[model samples]
Target: MEHSKLSLARRLKLQQLAIFEKVVETGSILAASRALHMTQPAVSKSVHELEAQFGESLFTRGKRGVKLTEFGVLLQRHAQSLLADLRFLADDVNAWSNGVSGQVVVGVLISASARLLPRAVVRMHETAPNVIVTVRVGSNDVLFPELARGVVDVVVGLLPDNQAEGTSGNLTHVPLYDETLCAVVARDHPLAGDPSIDPHQLENMAWIVPTQESAAWRSADAFFEAAGLVAPKRLVESVSILTNLELLLESSMVALMPHAVAEQFVRSGLLSILPLRLASSFGKVGYTLYAERTPTAATQRLLQTLHEVGESVRLELIANSPSTETR
Candidate 1:
């Protein structure tokens, strides 16, 4: 059995795997051939060789395109990881021979993107100026799967609350600090300067709330219930920070925002934190990575920077936002 494994490994080639991956991505052998700049017959031949070695059909053919069978779906997952690692390997080697220069792709949610990540990037430039930092902004639903698939080096935001829905228990979350969620509105809103807030007053106002699947939504729901308020009916359900900001500025919609995010806009005089505080609802902000993957040096440097910036942000939030004492 060991000999068979070795023989099969010898027969399989990286080019063949690359072709197979492109086919999976494009969903059509002809599209893969065009993308790879190879002849249609050549691309088909490589895929056939891969299928022969595996002894199972990877894709089922149809006139429009091809669809992955169960085996194909499994292989595609591993194939993507392998290719991403190879790219990182090349970058690592190049950086080693030269000065520090490589790419680190980070997935950031709204909480971290507003302050933590930008601060870290600036700090990283002070040390590893040549390191290329790319940021992909999205929610956990989009970022977590990318982290598992090795498409993102790290994710910086609120850590999941023991819920491993899409990741299948392969992620490692490193807690950096905790920040409270605050009720926010445009600086000129009627509730902006109120010294005392009433929970019932907010129920009639149009509000911006997170989608039900998010951790923030769960916390918000609980906070509202504890305050003896019914869920607002005049609602816009969204998790987009930019969209929420625009809606808040243009209309009188209130949003539950992380303290770190709210503080930045508050200083700029664009938004105000309502006196109504969610003292118990705090998000544990951190970075997450795939447990099995070894981060390249560039990624490790960025992680260290995140830790430094995270500490500073944590301290700043405590000194500035008084409501955190309750959390």
Candidate 2:
């Protein structure tokens, strides 16, 4: 009798998926085997079996290691989602058995990493101590896809400018608070604490701007345009908050930052906010999640804590502002 090929639905095994995912992640079957504490041949066999079942080559072997084929990339996406679901299931079961104990990977933009995320983590710790939290920081472009793909439980930072922007439309944002932009300089910069400093004069000096593709850059560019000026001729584009902070402290460069982020540095005497305020550039700060996916219990608790922290932050910002009107 002749044999028939098994459908992928019937052929797929969790073990094979796990092995394949590890190979993709490490970029080499041998490296994945080492990481998994399995023999290299065993890993290679599993990958070969997966390729046979799928009727496609998953990786291209190279002297350096391996690279995912086009099909490999596609499979990796679904594999990651499946693995994430497995983790969520394990966490869910553990929570039911022990307590609210699980892990959540959170993606954050620079703004949220400064204050909002830390405060919320501390609050979550006081309550759900067993809920382990991991944070990955990046721009909207990097975090949004991760959120949609289930790699991240939630994302925190400035909400995207619009649904049509460079973000997944399936994700939904919850506005926590509003934040405006403020120009900042090194504490010893020539314009530091100069109440009469003009935006036009700052143009002659070097400036640090967000990366061109980020939502922050769009808002910042609009801010400069509103002031009837182009971005400074001498500009350094970056998305790294730490690098930006260091650059501001070490040079005469001026940068625009979220008001809340600037206040933290200002309080520490590391950076000084320029007297200029960008009222029209108010951006919403909040957390985002996939619209269709139901959040695990641990994620729900974290979200609740974030809301509480957000309210406190909103109140604090209102109290500090000279104008009573909310941004």
Q: How accurate locally, in lDDT, is each candidate?
A: 0.84, 0.83
Error of 1 at 317 (Å): 0.9
| Candidate 1 per-residue lDDT over residues 1-327, each given as its tens digit | 243757967888889989999998899999999999999999999999988888889999999899999999988888888888887897789678875789899999877878999999999889889898888887888998988888789998888773332444788888788877778899999888887788788888898887787757776786677668788888888878889999999998898888898888998899988776546455688889898888888998899999999999989987766453322
- Regions more than 4 Å wrong, model 1: 1-4, 26-45, 55-66, 137-142, 162-170, 322-327
Each candidate structure's count of clashing pairs: 0, 0
TM-score, structure 2 vs. true: 0.90
Q: How does candidate 1 fare on TM-score? A: 0.81
The residue pairs in collision within model 2 are none
Model 2: per-residue Cα lDDT over 75-169, one tens digit each? 89999899989988987887888767898899998778888999999999898899999899888788888888889999998888733223356
Once fitted onto the true fold, the runs of candidate 2 whose alpha carbons sit more than 4 angstroms away are 1-6, 162-169, 322-327
